[model samples]
Target: MATTTKDRLIEATAELFRHQGYSATGVKEIVDAARAPFGSMYHFFPGGKEELGAATIRWSGAMYGELIEIFYADTSDPVAATRQFFEAAADTVRDTDYTDACPIATVALEVASTSDPLRRATADVFESWLVQLDAHFARNGLTKTQARSLSVSLFCLLEGAFLLARATREHRHIRAAGRTAAAAVRDALEHRASTVARRR
Candidate 1:
């Protein structure tokens, strides 16, 4: 299947947004990277950069969500799976010279305060990823509330670690975050187990 100009533009923009920030990235750069004609951008995105940015965020979020699901489905322990996910993420950041962090983190922080549409789009993506993690926790025997809170904590740790790791070019922070996240998940699961035992 031939990729459309719009697809190319989104792919390129998402990559740029991950490296640079949303405000720092330009439409020309995106089209140039995509190797698409300049006018095709406006034709595909009449609303211009903002529209394209939102689409890119959503696209990146959906792709990351699928990756998360794959890890959980393939692993026997969801908590360990989550740990391995962060470990892999930290390793990628190190291997890529600290340039390969979350696709949406930099853009999300930059646009969250300025672009209402883009902010909401990023927020939705973040929430969706959390929900994906939460679903994995729930499937592993956590109650809805427990799973949701644990997921939130895990994601916050990841985001925070990404910020620290990128700035420091060190995986220690992310590795620590992974440890904390794993403990949080394990604690939640243990608490749930105890509660269930008491009920039984």
Candidate 2:
């Protein structure tokens, strides 16, 4: 299928944002990377860079969340699924020379205080991820609140691990963080099971 110009622009902006950040990536760079016409950016996004940035955030976020769903879909055990997801992420970082991680993290941090629209875009993306993770945990025997809290914790672990791993150029941080997240999920599932048994 032929990719549309707008899609290419969004993808290019996302890639730039992943490697650099919102402030560092220019419209020209995006168009060049995307092989898109210069004026197409404004034509598709009248609000200019800010609008494009927000759209890129949402687009990248959805793509990442869908990836999580695909990774977890085949594995019924939530703990195993969690470990697999983190391990895969670590491998990807190492393979890509640490150039790839969460596509929105860089932009999210850069725009958190400076731009309201971008901040909201990041928040919405994070919330969507949390919702997906929460659903997976709940399906695996966790209470709604427990699932949501664990999802948040796991996300924090992954994001922080990505930063640490990239800085050190080592995979140990990713492995360690994955272990901790997997342990947390395991404990939650066990605790829920025990509680149910105790009530019976």
Candidate 3:
């Protein structure tokens, strides 16, 4: 299917936000990158850039979450799935020349202190991803609380690794972080299994 004008605008904004961030990226630049008309932005988003920013954050978040689901879906072993997910993330950074990582982290940091709506938008996205991850972990034998905690830990690890990787232009940080995360998942799963066996 052909991409619509609104889709182009959102995609362009998401790309710009991923690289330079929110305040630094202008509306004109987004339209230009999207090859969308000026009026179309307001037409699609009456609240203007703020609205678009929130939408882009949510949209990108949903897409990224779906990508995570795909990774987990491809493997039944949670540890392998976690390792594969982080390895792929590292590859993505290298492939994009370190220009792209998490689509909303830069914007989230920039507007977190200033914009209430945008901050909420970022929070919502993170929460959604966490919920999805927790579900996946739970399916793999973790209790709800353990799964949620592990999901948060993995998210923190990935975000921190993304920052370090981009700053140093090195994939070592990402690889190390991935290893740590995969180990954490493996350890948690093993512990849970042992407890279940003891109960049985």
Candidate 4:
């Protein structure tokens, strides 16, 4: 399916933001990448780069969230789902030559201190991802607190792994994080089961 010019602009900026970051990615570069007219960006986003950046952050965020749902949809086993996600992410990094990880992270790190709107966009996006993962774990057996905690743990692990993987040009960190994450999920489930049994 062909994308509209606006979609192309957003998606192009998203990729550039993932690789080069928000500030480094120029409006011309974005238009060139999108194959969009320079004027069209304003037509779609009058607030210019910041507006586009925020929108792209959100679009990318929702896309990542849906990916988790897709992985979870195939299995009820939280361990398998967790493993699948990290492994796939590692594969993607390798495929892209370690240039990409979370699409929002690059921009988030850059604009967090300088741009309030972009910072909030990133925070909201991160929270959205956390919420989705929390729900996934909760449905699998963990209580709300446990699920939320695990979600945060997995998020930190993945983000850290991505940083290391990019720095070293190796995917092992991601896989390692995946192993620890799966174990944590198992521990959470077992703890829940044990607590439930004790109460019985």
Candidate 5:
């Protein structure tokens, strides 16, 4: 399928936003990178950059959320899959020279206080991710409470590790965080399994 002009704009914007953040990336740069006409930005996004920013956030957020599904779906051993997922994240950061990490975290931090609309967009993306993670854990035998809590913890761990890893230019932070998260996941699963056994 050919990339539509609208898709190109979103993809280009997402790429720029992921690397340099929303404020640093200019409209010209977005168009140049996208190979899109200057007028197309307004034509596709009538409200301009802020509108485009929100769209990028939602699009990138959904794309990352799909990655979670790829990792954890239809698995007999979600715990192991969780470990592999984090390790792969570490690998990606390293491979990208630390420029590529979470798609929305940078913008979320940037616009959290300044832009109410952007802030809400980020919040929505985050909750969507949590929903996917929570469902994955819940299906793997964790109780609802346990799944939600673990979902938040794992989310926090990854985001924090990505921040640190990018700052230090060290991918090891993500790798170590992955190890720690895998342990937490394993512990939760084991505890849940034991409790259910006791009930049985």
Candidate 6:
């Protein structure tokens, strides 16, 4: 299927943002990378750069969330899924020479201090990811509270690990984070099972 111009714009901007952050990525670069006309950018996004940036963040978040869903669907065990997801993430970074990680984190940190619109956009993306992870845990046999907390921890571990891995140009941090996150998920699930059994 042929991709739309707006979709291309979002993807190109996202790639630029992931590499150089919000302040560094410009409309001309995005359009050029997207192979889109300059007028199309304004036509699609009347609110201009901020609007396009926010939309791009949301688009990337949703796309990445689908990847999480794919990993979860591939295995019934959420712990295994978690491990697999992180392993793939770490491998990708190593394969890409540590240039690729989360699409939103770099821009999130950079825009958090400068643009309210962009910061909110990034926050919305993170929150959406957290919600999806929490729901996956809950469906696989975790209490709501347990799922939410564990989701937060797992995401924080991943995000923090990315920073460390990028800084060190090593996959050790992310691999360790994956192991730790999987263990935590396992422990949480076991605790929930035990509590439910005692209640029964």
Q: Residues 1-200, candidate 4: write the lDDT tens digits.
A: 57999999999999999998987999999999999999999999999999999999999999998898898765779888889889999999999999879888888889889999999999999999889888888887788999999999999999999999998999988999999999988899899999999999
TM-score of each: 0.96, 0.98, 0.97, 0.97, 0.96, 0.94
Query: Clashes in model 3: which pairs?
Result: none
For 1-200, candidate 1 gives per-residue lDDT tens digits of 59988899999999899899888898889999999999999999999999999999999999988988888876658778878989999899999999888899998888878899999999999999988887788888998888889888888899899999999889889999999888887888889899999999
Pick the winner on TM-score between candidates 1 and 3. Answer: 3
Best by lDDT: 3
Of 1 and 4, the candidate ranking higher by TM-score? 4
Candidate 2 at residue 47, lDDT? 99
What TM-score does candidate 6 get on C-alpha atoms? 0.94
- Checking candidate 2 for backbone clashes, the offending pairs are none
lDDT of 2 at 155: 97
Question: lDDT at 25 for candidate 2?
Answer: 91
Model 5 ranges with Cα > 4 A deviation: none
Residue 26 miss distance in model 1 (angstroms): 1.1
Error of 5 at 67 (Å): 0.8
lDDT of 4: 0.92
* Prediction-by-prediction clash tally: 0, 0, 0, 0, 0, 0
Candidate 3 local Cα displacement, residue 196, angstroms? 1.0
Estimate, for each residue in 1-200, the C-alpha lDDT of model 5 and write its tens digit. Answer: 59999999999999999999989999999999999999999999999999999999999999998899899887878779888999999999999999889999999999999999999999999999989988888888888899999999999999999999999999999989998999999999999989999999
Against the unseen true structure, what C-alpha lDDT does each candidate score?
0.89, 0.93, 0.94, 0.92, 0.94, 0.91
TM-score of candidate 4 on Cα atoms, chains taken together: 0.97
Tens digits of lDDT, candidate 2, 1-200? 59999999999999999999999998899999999888989999999999999999999999999999987776789888899999999999999999898899988898999999999999999999999998888888888999999999999999999999988999779999999999999999999999999999
